[model samples]
Target: MSVQTEINLSQVVVRQSQKWQQLALGLLCMASISSPQYVWTLLTKPLLARLDVHLPVLQVTFSLLIIFQTFLSPLQGKLIDRFGAQRFIGIGTLLTGASWIGAAYSQSIWSLYLLYGVVGGLGTGIVYIGVVGQVMRWFPQQRGFAAGMVAAGYGMGAIITTLPIANSLASHGLTQTLVEFGVGFALVGWFASRGLRPAPNTDPIPSATLTTGRHYTPSKMLKHPLFWLLFFMMACMSTSGLMVTSQLAGFASEVGVSQVVIWGMAALPLAMSLDRLTNGLTRPLFGWVSDRIGRENTMFVAFALEAAAMTLWLTFRHDPLLFIVLSGVVFLGWGEIFSLFPATLTDTFGSQHATSNYGWLYMSQGVGSILGGPLAALLYQTSHGWVPVFSVAIGLDILTALLAVVILKPWRKRFLQH
Candidate 1:
């Protein structure tokens, strides 16, 4: 009954509540990421077949999805800053569920474009920013790993859904399968979005007081040369990865691989899942390394590995084992960028508005996604193979590496001061 004892009990209760909130947020993160992948299997083929559309035109729907996400993510971030997470995620989830169901009944390509491309993409954009921003807020001390875990869910969700959706499409027909996906997404997203609430009375923690003394405002961070360099680095990195992801099945077919084998290999979702899982685990480690060794140093290693992996693919395209190994490496390196970039943003820009700032940084991924497939397709058409295409990708990796070293120099002193 003592006043001191009451204070201690209140503190314990607060800590416990925060822990449960974090747990719920993490689960929400996983569900938010996974929901989109339900449609990946039907991205081109099933829809194209059912709707009787040309491949190129059908692919435009995919591009529209990326375009929507690209243009809307920053806006969503601003909304998150204004309204907080719970409301944004809840409304977004509702829209996303409706879009998916509408997509299932599309009688024309334009309808698909409207439903999946515009509505679904916009819905995802809102939820994506909400979940990721909330994670960063909840785990300011572990932003890199926290952000990576949420982002990784996006990749891993695709992996988890690929086989099941593919199987469903094969057996149940596209419309039914999508209908089921819509229902599932609606139910899960509703519960998950409702679970997302910000930690009470939390303020942005400055890195200076912590082990890493780096922070910047979005406007100020934009002034730094290194921010643009890192931004472009991520853009190109995304271009390379998405090119491969979107074209994996086609690539297998072009190389004279069997349909059964191609379908089996299409399970790059396994590789994708591993890539994301590794990213979640390694992000904090790399952040620690960046804190210790330096961000540029960590980036140098990532770009080098990425370039090397791409080279392996070019050299041994015929060997399935080598292809898978190289693909895995490529995905792993891609995950590193996702893991490191947000932390780098936090380091360069102040955490006062880190969520919004990083959201703009993430828009680079949408740009890359928009360009990646089309670029690869165009290059493949012109070159008659992936050889030329991958060569260009390698060049991009090299360019990113050089830029990272040059642009990050000014921050080197600041980083070392820590």
Candidate 2:
């Protein structure tokens, strides 16, 4: 072989290695963002006990976190588009770490709000857009799977951190635990962010897909009816999942289950772990399924399954076995929403601007998060029961299913055909 051809092959090998590195980085970025969920239980308990706050009041922290994610995502999306992922990841990771450290020293809810809710949430949002955008760029053909893997890391990170955080809280106080997590996450995330790099000009496949006639800017996308329908569907789906996750233990107790059963239900994290795993697996599976069966069909199946899961939960509240089964079903179906939406959006608007579009799509999740906590709290307070909360969730899922069937059908046909 000619020396020039050998050199070209060597360069190709290097580029392939770099892409794999980027994928690993994307996974780490997700893990860092997700690690906080495990810490949620720990923080709430200690803050309420030590600071003498009530659960309802302390729960506002979650709302603040969601609100930060909603507002910060668009800004992070724009930054990633202009400056690329590396700088955003670096600075964002640093801020994430600093926020943890600050949280450790927090003596009041306001201090925790400024640290955990604002700074940490913003940091996660920044890294989130960068990692997701980088992964999508790396795997244009396998966007769903790639997005799934990245998102799954976030879920899995919670599983990985839960035991450690739980153990740490038992041995060390909250302050010390926060310090450790803050420093560790920052260091790990900073190194991981270093792996992100802009796609080379030669990486032209995704760009070509964009040029093939369907492209919509953010404003243009908003003008389309399909976008709002999907947006509301996403928001509703997320609200259901978040409500269940945040209130699982409380609901279990309210149903007259023993304290032992309540603690056993901590196994809900294990369920959530499974949910994340299935989420990663399903994205590629569902995305591929959408390619064949159609995106609308795939979403129809997902939402229908979700509605059934919620209904089952309401019906079987007293049955542990059935509740577990329904919980798994709900999480699996919920996972599909995260996995499929990006692929659907990319198909509609084109992958060239997918990160920004999906970033906005993710804000719907933030909106759900903001609403889920207070809504569930209010429902539980007024009804003095869990049944009403689950009932409302079922209605939302059914509405989402209807919208998917009617509105999303035509949108998918128009956008995904080419």
Which candidate number has the best lDDT? 2
- In candidate 2, which residue pairs clash? none
**How do the residues 122-200 of candidate 2 rate in per-residue lDDT, one tens digit apiece?**
8877877777777776766666667767776765666677667767987998889989988988998898888678866
**TM-scores, in order shown?**
0.86, 0.89
Once model 1 is optimally superposed onto the true structure by TM-score, how far is the C-alpha of residue 397 displaced, in angstroms?
1.9
Candidate 1: the clashing residue pairs are 215-349, 215-350, 216-349, 216-350
Q: What is the lDDT of candidate 2?
A: 0.73
lDDT of candidate 1 over 273-362, digit per residue (tens): 444455444544565565555667777887877788879876876765556566677766656676677766765565556667777887
Worst 10-residue lDDT window, candidate 1: 206-215
lDDT of 2 at 297: 79
